[model samples]
Target: MIRTLVISISSLFLCLFFTACVRDTDFDQAEDISLSPIMELDLIYFNLQASDFYDTINGTPILTLRDTTEIKFLDDSTLQESLKRADFYFKFTNSIPRSFQVDFEFLSEENNITYETGTAVEQGEVSTPVITEFTHIVEGEAISQLTLANKVVVSVTIPSSNENLQGTLNMKSKTTYFLEY
Candidate 1:
């Protein structure tokens, strides 16, 4: 009888302890949950420069414009294609008075990728790449990168007879990037 009484008391106490810990207070309040989801947008701006015309940029043109290609992190959607700028240019001062056409190419490892500037370029835009002759080079190449989500581009120019041309030309380039978000 003693043992039975002790076990019953302990069990009863345990039951009450657990039960008391689970009491619900009825405050009667409505829930105001927010439905909008939050997302991260990392916009990495890159100050682009024309390091080299032949091998440096020619080999990996897209990598040259690495900053402009990082526009895919604005939303929740995964990046299937990389965004690119098309209004690329170069500025040059020709020693001799001559007329020549300059160009550039943005090559990416990915397939079917293209680059195109959504809007037109203005004159004397600094900090960013302006499609000009010497910005990249005006000797033989015709243009530099100027497009979005593109792969390859080619600028063509002929030799000048007298003085070399000196100015800036806003050209386009091809860039192929993949969205992995």
Candidate 2:
């Protein structure tokens, strides 16, 4: 009889202890919850350069710009939206009067995709050297949906001329990530 009484007392004490340990929570009152959602945004930039036009192959002068560059975007698993925009700037100084055509091609190494952006023509008819600048903006959907790690192949074609032209290329990209919880 004593053993039975002890076991009953112990079982009641355990039930009471477990019941007190579990606190009732009202999920309807969400404001009282300690955890909350958050939102975030970010912007990123990139650049590229080419500086030599003095080399010639097979006695033929070459002035085409071929460069490989790296870039970073958001991961695919991240539940966020992003937009990528880019601006390509080319600056050159001509030593003599001449007319030239510029063409651009961009390739993505991650996806093996190629994009033929644009082409421009400029004429320098002055006797003195002059500095010229050209700009191209990239706003394509294919480029905006890039992976976190990527490479961009830049190809520029400029016909060779008797006049010498020294130039530099720069690319600036902006990535805007919109994250909401």
Which candidate leads in TM-score?
Answer: 2
Off by over 4 Å in 1: 1-80, 84-87, 105-156, 159-181
Q: What is residue 169's positional error in candidate 1, in angstroms? A: 13
Residue pairs in clash, model 2: none
Top candidate, metric lDDT: 2
lDDT of 2 by residue, 2-35 (tens): 9999999999999888887535867677765443
Give the per-residue lDDT digits (tens) of candidate 1, residues 76-132.
122222222112233343222223343333443353333322222233323332333
Give the whole-model CA lDDT for all candidates, comma-separated.
0.32, 0.46
On a 0 to 1 TM-score scale, where does candidate 1 land against the true structure?
0.23
- Against the hidden reference, what TM-scores do the models get? 0.23, 0.42
lDDT of 2 at 36: 27
Measured on C-alpha atoms, candidate 2 has an lDDT of 0.46
